[model samples]
Target: MKLPVLYTFRRCPYAMRARISMYYSKISYEHREILLKERPKKLYQLSPKGTVPVLNLPDGKVIDESLDIMKWSVSVNDPDSWYVNNIDHQLEIISINDKEFKKWLDRYKYHDRYPEYSVEYYRGKCEKILDNFEKILDSEKFLFSNNISLSDIALLPFVRQFSNVDIIWFRNRFINLSGWMDELIGMDIFQAMMKKFEIWNPFGKGEEVIFNN
Candidate 1:
């Protein structure tokens, strides 16, 4: 069968979330692990910008954005209702995470790039978002409620990125948020989503790596 092709970088938070959502939805696809520096020619052919987590459907539709890939995956088969309930609010929170929080996270992670501000200042900006999440998690197990939803999966990868920057500081600061992250990260689907794959070689025999097979 000609499954949808997924061009992904293992460590990118955007790609990670896409993979996680696809795994949760149990949608089978061809996984093409790519290096950002040495991206395959096919990726650029499919997407001019050549970003990771680009899904090329067998029907010739291309979805380059990670969030859109996630939505498409769940739309195919959402057994856990990840896309349901308070969709507008969930999408709003995801937008904030992708736009506002990610900016500070990048600055915080690579503080030396922006020497105008100290690392702490950038972290402080990220913490404001974390603090809001902490308050929400304190009230409920997940972002929306006890059950995991689209918002939780959409934002968890970025939160994981934030915690990785300074895990000690993150663990020391947010108890509720830490537990929430731990719960999501410890899930079986997360482990499957993180399974490593050899870099795809378009020039080689074109080996098919089935995602979550």
Candidate 2:
């Protein structure tokens, strides 16, 4: 029997999170690696707003939002107890991650486009939130507690992107945050989710990429 199809772009942090959730939950799905510039016609038919990490359920339902995809993945099977926590705080942290910090991240990564400020200025803007995350890691193994949770998975990819922007500076300044992030990134699940796949062509009826635990 055919499983659900998951459309994803390997480099997108949002898509990374969605893939991480599904992989960690041990959900079976057909992975469709799509190029952002040349999206598949089937994807546009399912979601006009066309984005990566779009999951088409076997029942014909489509989930486009990355966070929604993560929630649905864990809802179906949370093997690591990712949802067993203070739901409110988890949601609050992820909200800030996806909204406010992401703004600074975009500006920092593409400071040339947003030439209103120096790249340093945008990097400084991001530190406001990074400082808080640093403090969190200073005390706990994960965001809310020692064990992994939804908030940790949701926020790490963005932080990873930030660290990559200035690796030397990030390594020098964010000792605690780096350590916390390193442990998560080093895990088997992260490695598996990051495996490369060829760009999918719907018309070819090619073999599907299957992600598993």
Candidate 3:
């Protein structure tokens, strides 16, 4: 079978989630690392919106959204049944993480770009997301259950970006959330997914990074 090709950017939270899901599902593919400023022409042609984490399937289908790519990869081999139960809840939280939380996260991370608000204001907004995660972790080790699920894997990358915005401030804000972040980021899956790759050059054959469990 022809392996799918995945275009990714290492530090992007969305791309991180896609790589984690593909790794967890043991989906082998040719990983192409791209730069936001110097994206490959094929990537733009395939996904006009031109976001990273785009998956070009062997069947010629293209999945441009990170969530869709996660579902596609997990469906291939879900030993943990990551998507079978609590799907509605999973989607609900993931949506909030992607939409509302991400809005505040960007503002907080790049306060200079969105100068309308103070850093504290944006930080406060994102803290609500951390509050929600802390409440969930108070009862369970992972979101949705004791074991890792779609919610845990899907949400962690964004939370990681939020945490890195001001590590000292973040660590002080939510103890439970901080512990949870430490645990998830320390996992083998996270480590493997975050391995560095050279920037892709469409003019030449770039090395492929495989995301196999």
Off by over 4 Å in 3: 209-213
Clashes of each: 0, 0, 0
Reference-based lDDT, each prediction:
0.89, 0.90, 0.87
Instruction: Report lDDT (Cα) of residue 12, candidate 1.
Output: 94
User: Cα miss at 4, model 1 (Å)?
Assistant: 0.6
- Candidate 3 per-residue lDDT, tens place, 130-211, comes to 7988898899888888878887888898888888878898888878888887888898988988889888777765455555
Can you list the residue pairs that collide in candidate 3?
A: none
Clashes of 2: 0
List the candidate 2 regions with Cα displacement exceeding 4 Å. 206-213
Which is superior by TM-score, 2 or 3? 2
Model 1 vs. true fold: TM: 0.96
RMSD of each: 1.6, 1.5, 1.5
lDDT of 3: 0.87
Sort all candidates by lDDT, best to worst: 2, 1, 3
**Clash count, predicted structure 3:** 0
